[model samples]
Each structure stands twice: as C-alpha cells, then as structure tokens.
Target: AQSVTQLDSQVPVFEEAPVELRCNYSSSVSVYLFWYVQYPNQGLQLLLKYLSGSTLVKGINGFEAEFNKSQTSFHLRKPSVHISDTAEYFCAVEVSTNAGKSTFGDGTTLTVKP
Candidate 1:
C-alpha cells in the first residue's frame, strides 16, 4: 500500500514570494510520485512527476520538485509565485504493481495575495 501526506493544509504567500509545498509518501516497494494543481472551478492538472532517473523534475507553470528516495519525500517549490498561481495542490503516489492503486494527499491550498 502507498500513501501520501501533505504537511501543510494551507499556505498563504504574497505575490512574488517563494513557496515550498512539502509532501511525503510511504510505500513498501518502488513508487512514482506526482504533483497536481487545480485552479478554481477547474480540473486537476499535472504539475510535476518523478518516475525514474533524475531526482529533480520540472513541470508546467515554473514548478519543480525533487524526489528524495532516502527520505521518501517529494517537495514542490517555485522561485516566485503570482496571483495566478493560487490553487489547490495535491501529492500522489502510484505503485508499480498492476493493482492500479494510487493514493492522493488531502491537498494544500496555496493562496497568493497581492
């Protein structure tokens, strides 16, 4: 079984400020990590992912996350944020097994104010 945990329920930041969203996962075997963003009244979109190879992975909208295998962490970060960046972010983990099972965190609401 795999599970995801988002450390923060909400993060409030002013426009242009840097932000980091912490995420951790637990799994007995290898797993793929992902980050998704959901804007107001919109569907979820993939922000970044960590499947294999490099620990650092980049995604849409200037977002990036590093996979720390030892710590079982995949924290998302951005150098700067804008009002448009305000959205709900979710962390998920997928096991390589064919059971087609995956888990998502409760989500982190990022509020970017001007």
Candidate 2:
C-alpha cells in the first residue's frame, strides 16, 4: 500500500527568495522517489530522484530535496527562485525497479512574483 500527500497545493513567493514544497508518502515496501516540474501549459520533467545513495539529492534549476525515511517525506527546496521558476511541481513515487506503477500528488503551484 502506497500513497502520497502534498501538504501545500500552492505557494506564492517573490523572485530570488527561497521556498520549500512539502511532501509525504506511505508505502510498505521500498520505492523510487521523484520530483517533477511542469511549466505553464507544458509537460513534466524529471527534477530529481532517490534511487540509492545519499539522502540529500541535488536537481536542476538549483532545486534539491531530502529523503527522510523516518518522516516518510521528500520535501523540495530552492535557495533562490526566478520568476521563470513559476510552475507546477509534483512529488511522485513508484516501485524501486523497472516495475511501472506511478502515483502523483494533486500538484503544487508555485507562483514567483517579479
């Protein structure tokens, strides 16, 4: 049994400021973690993943997240954001291998002010 919950559905911040999007999940077995970003009217792109190794994983556009086993969370963080960064973000999880079952959170809309 696995499920993902995105605490915040929307976040508004000014450009160059830092932000964090909170996420949590529940699964009985091991799994793969992923954060994807979708720009306005665009598709999603892989921002990062936690297949193995370090808990702290860095991703594109200066984004990063930490996999906290205890909390069952993988919250995304960005130090400084650009207006260009305004988009929808999703936290997703799947089985650890080639097995194909993906579940996405409703999504978090990030609004970056100019």
Candidate 3:
C-alpha cells in the first residue's frame, strides 16, 4: 500500500518569488512520485514525476522536484512564481506493483499575489 501527504495546506507568495510545496509518502514497496497542478476549475496537469534515474526532476512551467529516498519525500519547487501560477498542487505516489493506481495527497493551495 502507498500513501501521500502534502505538509502544507496553503502557501501564499508574491509574484516573482520562490516557492516550495512539501510532500511526503509512505509505502511498503518501491514507488513513483508525481506532482500535478490544477488551475481553478480545470483538470489536473502533470508538473513532474520521479520514476527512476537522477533525484532531481524538472517539469513544465519551470517547476522541479527532488526525490529523497532516505526522507521519503518529493517536494516541488519553483525559483520564481507568477500570479498565473496560483493553483492547487497535488502529490501522488504509485506503487511499482500496481500500475495505473495512485494515492494522492489532499493538495496544497498556492496563492500568488501580484
């Protein structure tokens, strides 16, 4: 079984500022981690993922995340954020044994002010 947790429920930042959304997970088997962003009422968009290889993974819209094995974490970050970046972010974990099935965190709301 696998589960994910987004440490912060909300994060408010000003435009052009750096931000990080923390996420942690627990699982019995090896897993893949992913970050998704939802803009307003729109569907989720894939931000980044960590299936294998290097610990640092970059995604669309200049977002990136690092997979920490020892800490069991996958935190998303952006060096600079824009007002358009305001949205809800989700962290998910998929067990290697179970394909197409994922456990998602509650989500972290990122509010970027101008």
Quote model 3's TM-score.
0.97
- Give the top-scoring candidate (lDDT): 3
> Tens-digit lDDT track for model 1 on 1-114?
788999999999999999999999999899999999999999999998999999999999999999999999999999999999999999999999836777999999999999
Q: Tell me the spans in candidate 2 whose CA falls farther than 4 Å from its real position.
A: none
TM-score, predicted candidate 2 vs. hidden true structure: 0.96
Tell me the TM-score of each prediction against the true structure: 0.97, 0.96, 0.97
Give the candidate order by descending TM-score: 3, 1, 2
Give the runs in model 3 whose Cα sits over 4 Å from its true position.
none
lDDT of 3 by residue, 70-95 (tens): 99999999999999999999999999
Candidate 3: minimum summed lDDT over ten consecutive residues — where?
Answer: 27-36
- In candidate 1, position 110 carries an lDDT of 100
What value does the lDDT take at residue 47 in candidate 3? 95
